[model samples]
Target chain A: MLGLAAVPLIADVIDEPFYTVMFSRMLILSIGAISLNLILGFGGMVSFGHAVYMGIGSYVVGIGTFHAIEDGISWMGNGLIHLTIAVVFSALTALFIGSISLRTRGVYFIMITLAFAQMFYFIAVGNDNYGGDDGLSLYTRSKFYNILDLSNDNSLYYLNFTLLIVFLYFSHRLINSRFGILIRGAKSNEKRMENIGFPVYRYRLVAFVIAGVICGIAGVLSANQTDFVSPAVMHWTRSGDLIIMVVLGGMGTLFGPVIGAVAFLFLEEFLSGITEFWQIIFGPMLVLIAIFGNGGIDGILVRLDKWWQIKK
Target chain B: MNWILLLEQIMNGLQLGVLLFLLAAGLTLIFGIMDLINLAHGSLYMLGAYLAATFTNWTESFFVGLLLTLPACMVLGMLLEIIAIRNIYTRSHLDQVLATFGLILFFNEFVRLLWGPIGLDIQLPEILNGSVELIFGIRYPAFRLAIIAAGIIVAILLYLLVSHTKLGMLIRAGASNRQMISALGVNINLLYTIVFGLGAALAGLAGLMAAPIMTVEIGMGEEILILTLVVIVIGGVGSIRGAFLAALLVGFIDTVGRSFLPDILGFFVTNDVADTAAPAISSMLTYVLMALILAIRPQGLFPPKGV
Candidate 1:
């Protein structure tokens, strides 16, 4: 809450493109993290392959815009058509993968998802038409029917911010709904849910699809923000990064991933600026967090809230 | 296809399988005995390659380097188990995954910093450098044959140790039930550390053996690590026998697919398209095998009873 309230104030004081760009990037990444938390945190699906959704999303925008600029094929206004296609494609892919993967449990599921993602990563690297390992560039942002100019820094920032708000709202509502209760219950105890007459697999699969769709949206924004899409986006290591964000923020909390994404990126930017051996420091820090900080940043906030309520 | 080439590819597949078994043996043992998923197992392999390359450079003798580095890696393995891994036995898998994943990042970067990003060649000793003539005018690298010999020897030793000795019984017992082992007054912590150290040493040995044939470099562990995971998944989580068999199956399928899939596809599709699509399709072979295996038997081919 404090971070969201302070965003405009921070924007006002910074008044620079570089800071704005950084903030926008943080928003997009946070969206990705939050999307992952839906499945991993709430639905109890530890998919080590979530970054594929982002890759699919980014590639959709990249390919769509590339064709628009190169071949002059604008099927619809701006790039909304492409964004929708990306979301649907990502969701369908998730459906296929989840059906097979959800059949296994524990470490097997994790490894299978990881292997499938690596397959996708390699395919992206091998596709010569899509620039192969070099990646594709979007010379122009999505047209969006000229309702908004994505090239403008402020316009893009607001666009990302608005999407972030919408996503958070949807996530909030979904988690509070009856469907959310079933999913969370399944996460806590799948057998118990099954005993209670809920088809646990169906609920988890739905959650997985929802998470993939949300991630797809983030992917489109990411491509537009960076003006590039590459195989790197889908790398398993990137998926690991999203997992770190969710865990660091306090898994199962609505805003925990958001806080985690902010802190993680800021720490990366800050530490890398300080030294080339930033990962050495960051890596151990994450280990220490996993070992000691089980509750994450949000856990600390919850404690503070309790203390404040007592004081009042 | 010519029979000789086909036979050669089969041999190559077996050789690859033997190499994978060397890596998977330790990995599955660690997973089975300790209930720990050590992603950093790959880092140990990477370290072994690095250490072997560096030591060989220093000693100017591959034999001497291998002799010296074996104990050095074993000691490093024990040290790592004591310092970092011992504390995580009771933690959740999520925590284990994150912490180990962090270790991977740290180790990869540390290796790059220490050895530079470029790959190093670990030259084979002259004694094992040449190819040996086989029947039908076939020839195979002597070092790879040595690797196969070493893998079989280790597998036999592992089998004898696990099935025929006191330590092996304890390991089997531990895998079956950690709490029961503890109840029986076994020093479970020490046992876990030993198992982990052994696993690490095995991984290091595989790395050292692979170094001369493949370029020793950072992140080499990641690809092999995934293959090892597949082996464990197909073989069964806690069964060494499963790992050995699965490793061979996976290795043969992968090798044969990559080698023969193109020519086979050429008979159906145009040569140009077949050449391009074959490699991609071939790469999916292990994953397809894994999916099929899961579909048939979710617990894997040889999951330890009750696991």
Candidate 2:
């Protein structure tokens, strides 16, 4: 958290805008990981297609702007309106997908979600208006009601940073509430929770929708940051990346997703800079982590905290 | 719509279905016997294709190259099982997914590193290259017919081994109840390794057959892997018969839909609208079919006995 806060100042001292931009990307991705963690880490719903919501969010922005420019309706391309549509569309799709997907458990659930994501991917690629497989480039960043200039890099970075903090607080409060406990309980043992008179399905669906909405917001921000939205953003591998981030940071921890996003993105930047086939190294590292690092970075930190207390 | 064109499409669909069955057979068996989801099963298929491409170049004989690929893929599959996958059999499905997903990344990059990102072309031998004239003046590629014949033979062999042989009996028993079979003093570990190897061999055969028809490139496994999953899901996991039937159904639906959906849509809507929506809807038909089947029978069309 302290490191996040200090990024802007560090960027200024280094005289490099890259740090701010990179951290902004991390912040947006953290938002995505945090949303995924809500259901996957706490609710035990391993959605292999969670990145679809992100893609939907991005296409909403991309498509809206394309129409606005084509038809010359300036109102259609407004940032707030695009955000609203993204949130609503994503939440509704989540509701439909979750209701069906949550019916099956284990691998069935995983495969069904994956099929839905693939369906959306093919649909996106089939749309010629949105650049088909190539994706659409945004001519202008989304405009607010003149309250803040998104074209300014610093403004966009701070906006993303502020939202990241807000979402962290929201998730923290959410998991502590009574609803969070029920969701977590369902994850650990569904039959037991159902036997106790809890409507497990509804809780799971709500959590699924919430997570989808949050990720959708992240998607909107991601489109703004990149100034482009493509089918590649919603590829199944990106969903895998999100899952990796949550697991690496520590499942069921508030700040774990944030830590994971930073680590993952930085490694990606660092490794890809060195060689083209960076996955050769990253893949084995992921396998080793799954094999050995059960608790992930947060687990290691907790142990360090315990050792410090004992030493004191 | 000419009768010959329709006949050709049906044959193409059947060919695709046969290939899909080869891929899904290993996947379903692994899922049945071990209850592990190996995402990297597709990686094995990719490896087989790459190895076949390399061996074909060396031996200059496609048939010999294929024969060599079978043992190589089987050994690699067993090695993967013993080294990485064995440990995760006891772990959760999520863990298995993550670990295997890692393997996919590793294998894809590894293949890219070796193959240099360029697709390899596998030329058909002289006999299989030409189209065979059928009755009523219809002609079909001999290679496709050979693939279909090979797939059927493998299917029959798999059925015989499962129903007639002791190892096959052990596999069915293991799938039904792992603990009971183990309690009866069966070496479940060895059985698992064999099953994994067999599955790897099957996937490799499919890849080798497909090399001449499709582009042998990186991530080809993933493109087909998802379709194979849809096949298994619709067919019912852990059922070889189910995979066979479902693979054909999905393949026919997909191929036929891609070919005929635009024409069907044009009958109702304007040409422009049909052109735009047809591709999207056509691509989505199989998924829609899977979803419908799932809604009606969550266990799939033909679930294994006692599962």
Candidate 3:
């Protein structure tokens, strides 16, 4: 609730083109991270290929805009159709990969997902038509009935913000549903869930597909925001970044991924400005967090809340 | 493809598979025995290559440089284990992943700082620089053949050590049940350190050997590390025998697919389409194999007993 009120005030302070752009980027990434948390945090599915959904989303925007520009198609015919295709495709791919990957527990799941993501990355790089290593550019942003002028910074930022809110609400509701309980239970103990007559694999697969679809939506927003898409979006390191965001925010919480994404991007921007070797500091910082800060930023907040209660 | 060319490619694939095995063996063993995920294992490989390159430049002798650098990598591995890894044995995979990933970023940046962003080439020894002619006029690189031979020797030695030696028995036992082994009064800490160091050394050995063939640069380990992880997954975590076979399967599939997929696809489609699609398909081949294997056997081809 505090965050809800602070949003406009924070926006008013950084009410510039650059800050608007950065904020929108953070929102899109937060959406992706939140989607990942649904599967990884709640369902115990450690996917190293989550970035592929983002790539799929971005490519949908890029390809849709590209063909629309060349063919003069209507916004509904081009933009909406392409976006639908992207979400469906990403979900299907996630379903196929997750079905097999979820069969293996623990380290095997992690490695297989990583490899599959890398495979998609290589395929994207190999496709010369899609700009290969250079990436594809949208000549213009998708014409969304001009209801939301993506070309305008403020307008686009709000659109992303609205989308983020919708997705967060959707995710929150999902987690509190009966389906969510099964997923959480499966994560806690797969054997127990199975013994309780829930088909653990089926629930996890559904969660995986849902996560993929959400990430696909984020990817579309990312493509619209940047007006570009590339194989780099699907790289394993990119997946690692998403995982870091989730961990940083405090996995399984409603606001954790958003906080993580905002903090991470801001840190990257601030640190990179200080020195070219920013990663040297950032890397050790992550290690320190892992070693000492087990619960991430949100975890610390919870601890503080408990302490305050004790004091009272 | 000509029979001779096919034979050459197969040999090349075998060589690549062997190198992957050396790296995967260490990774799987550590994961299986210590129950720790070490994402920075690739950094040790990069270090070995960098150290080998530096020492070779210093001594002007590849063999001598390798001899000195191998033990150095082992020590570095042990030291890192003591300092960072030992503390995380009881932590979640997420912590291990993040911490090790941080190490990778640090090491990559550190390497960039030390050696510029450009890749360095490690020259092969003059004695092993040339190619050898086999039957049917086929020729193969001596260095590649040496890598294959070394891989085989290591595999045999590892097999002997794991199956025959007391330490190997302890390692196998520890992998199956760590608490039970500790209850038997074995020094778990020392065992973990040694296992981690051994794993590092094996990864380093792969790096040193591969330095001549592949580019030596920052982030070079990332791609190969993914492949090594695949090998571990397919072979079954903590099983040396599984790592060996899976590594070979991955190496052969990747090499052969890259070489022949385009030509084979051309027969069915237009050359232009085949040319464009082949690379993508070939790159996805190993992953397809991995997915297929997991779908059939979730525990991998030979999951260590009790893992």
Itemize residue pairs with steric clashes in candidate 2: none
lDDT of each: 0.87, 0.91, 0.88
Query: How would you order the candidates by lDDT, starting with the best?
Result: 2, 3, 1
lDDT of 3 by residue, A47-137 (tens): 8889999999888888777777777765623556667888899999899888888887777788888888998898889888878989998
Name the candidate that leads on lDDT: 2
RMSD (CA, Å), each prediction: 1.9, 1.3, 1.9
Model 3 vs. true fold: TM: 0.96
* 2 versus 3: better lDDT goes to: 2
Model 2: lDDT of residue B288: 86
For model 2, residues B151-235, the per-residue Cα lDDT tens digits are: 8898889999989999999999999999999999999999999999999999999999989899999999998999999999999
Top-DockQ structure, candidate number: 3
Task: Please provide, for model 2 over A88-203, each residue's C-alpha lDDT reduced to its tens digit, 9 standing for 90 to 100.
Answer: 99999899889888888889999988898888999999999789999999887777879978888788888888889999999999999999999999999999999999999999
Q: List TM-score per model, in order.
A: 0.96, 0.98, 0.96
Compute the lDDT for candidate 1.
0.87
Query: What interface root-mean-square deviation (Å) does model 3 yield?
Result: 0.9
The list of candidate 3 runs beyond 4 A from truth reads A1-15, A74-78
